[model samples]
Target chain A: MFFLSPFELKGDIDSVFERDPAARSILEVLLCYPGLHALILHRFAHRLYLARIPLIPRLISHGTRFITGIEIHPGAKIGKKFFIDHGMGSVIGETTEIGDNVTMYQGVTLGGTGKHSGKRHPTLGDNVVVGANATILGPVHIGAGSRIGAGSVVVRDVPHDSTIVGVPGRVVRHKGEKTYDVSLEHGKLFDPIESLNAKLEQKMAHLENRVAELEKEKRRSA
Target chain B: MFFLSPFELKGDIDSVFERDPAARSILEVLLCYPGLHALILHRFAHRLYLARIPLIPRLISHGTRFITGIEIHPGAKIGKKFFIDHGMGSVIGETTEIGDNVTMYQGVTLGGTGKHSGKRHPTLGDNVVVGANATILGPVHIGAGSRIGAGSVVVRDVPHDSTIVGVPGRVVRHKGEKTYDVSLEHGKLFDPIESLNAKLEQKMAHLENRVAELEKEKRRSA
Candidate 1:
């Protein structure tokens, strides 16, 4: 009996189901879900972290990561109002602290510099949006209100009143855009997809070419 | 009720619980799992492929690949009695009709070749063992009673009662001291993952290095 009921998890579970057009029913996610197991473990770990169990709490987190590839370091203090989207290959490193109201996409790595110790991994101030395949490395502090672009490999500190993009991300747009408090309105993260659609498109195009070639060959045979 | 119980659906439900050294309780896996959802979706697609849903099945299979790096083509008729190791970034292509009694490692890609389109994927014969990160491409066939080496990129059709290894896999050994009925012993298919343990170890090693360097630097500073 953790603080939240397992039934309450249905809301987020429903979100996943809503996206997956293939899912037949809800009972499927409830009975045999490792995701559910992970949630329960995180809750226990979070409680242990709050109770100041110290190293053991972090150990639990690492064990979870080993099985799941979704790492949430115990030292990285996350607020209660937190949820992950399409949680695969997502790494949250130790010493990286996140504030209230943050949503991250898939393949988002909250990692450290190659050789830096003590407070490496970004100190994400409140209301931060990290795009997919984004790597935020080093001990750099990101301002409270910032949006990191997809596939960005950030190394330095990001200013609060700006939007960052590209490798070694730089501010792309921030002149007149409203500094919308991410906490006030942190909408759902993007659809948890990497390049599935693109690959399908590629295959479809390949098929089209093949069909055309086949037709040409048929004409030759004719 | 759904078609199959979550406990029975091996692909998506956290079936890891069945393994030794697994989690103590079911609650721990749900919240933090990164690959559970993908695995679940994979089970459905894999089954659909068995039912022969044609292109839609493959499309949905690609969708699973996009969401999770693990790809199991719907057209590749795989047998039961198999397991995926790490199950990340693994690709099993179309036209690869696998026999019973086979196993594969992680980062393994069973793909097709130039636009010939006649049973594009490899037909893996029975009682075969493919190592981690091995790539078996083209419509070429792999004979029954064979073992493919890890990190090998295979292109040619393998001989029966043989062992292939290396970049363009060369026969390492033939007549590997074993005698079993290839017809009766079924093949198995799943994602390769045992090879990925090195990555986890590397992460731990990198962390150790940082701590060791910090201690040395602290001594110098003092």
Candidate 2:
């Protein structure tokens, strides 16, 4: 029930309309807005989690994710200046600690390795940028001022002030990456099945190439 | 968000103190207070969904479920007199059409078979009773006056006035079988791993019996 009345929503809407650069009109947003609903519910549920109520708080968080497709775990500790854009299927795990000035796009999973039981999941240092659907699995640490590229599956710890990209998220840059507040909003909300299909296609292609190479060696041996 | 006003909540608390059964003074329901939150949110979101503002409606529904354990889909057409008990991981598919006087318990999924493209999912007629974790997949029709048992996985069309039970659900009772509307709330939400473990246990027991029979046959032959 985290929805405010039109009277109370007046101030919030006005602020968004006045400050947020992306908005053109309030009517448009009122007419068609999904993010607004998610953001508001998350805020309340997150507050309840902070209050330390058992079962009900967790249930509320669970309910929010199920309806909105934005998965923010009740136990995750997020610091100041955190923003999520088109945040569907973005899973932030329990025992994960997020530092100040961090921005994340859709499908980002700060997950733990499945087998281990207690106090698993990542610890993100200040000013980290996690891109779309990037999976930072295991109890790893991503240091301050690091940029994780889209679709990266990072298993290891990242050093401070580094840029990571591609599958397995290789470091692309290590320039002076300062901690700054930035909001991410764009095409990250679209269908993730496309990216999944692409990964499968690439794997199939690699397997085919290996098969071809093996056939060529057989022919030479013959 | 859709949280109660502090003032209104105070009144509710006062009423509970003054009256024996103010709203929810029952010991069982008081212990499981979160169910009330879930039920209310589902009605609101479902109402919004019926209004045809698709995205926001779904977002609200998701947000509600995220906070609660209940999981009701936005597009699923639920009728009046519909009751949900311990509504956790209860995935009603996009095109599911439920009728009046229908009730379901936790983990019930009116799901689709495969990648359903057109007219996907089942259509449950009026006065139907679906139990816990019962997956009624495909575009099948469960006729009016039917009772689908707990943990049933129905794929085919069910006739009117019948009772179905077990995996690949078979009609265990003929017409005129009494329907039970006794609501039960299990503490645990629908955990897939837990369900898998239960199934595995049953399968293993069956395998052990088969092995024992095989050993006995071999001994007799010798």
| Winning candidate number (TM-score) | 1
Docking class of 1: incorrect
Estimate, for each residue in A1-222, the C-alpha lDDT of model 2 and write its tens digit: 443456545643553443246777778755544344454565566667677655665556556666655566666777654656555656666668888657676666775443234656788997677876566755789988787777555667888877765433456556664434321222223333355456556655655565566556557657
CAPRI accuracy category, model 2: incorrect
Q: What lDDT does each candidate get?
A: 0.58, 0.60
Off by over 4 Å in 1: A1-40, A114-117, A160-162, A175-222, B1-222
Q: Per-residue lDDT for A100-157 in model 1, tens only?
A: 5565644578898776567777788766767545678888887866777544568888
Lowest lDDT sum, 10 consecutive residues, model 2 chain A, at A182-191
lDDT for A4 in candidate 2 is: 43
Two-chain DockQ for each candidate model:
0.03, 0.03
Calculate candidate 1's fnat.
0.00
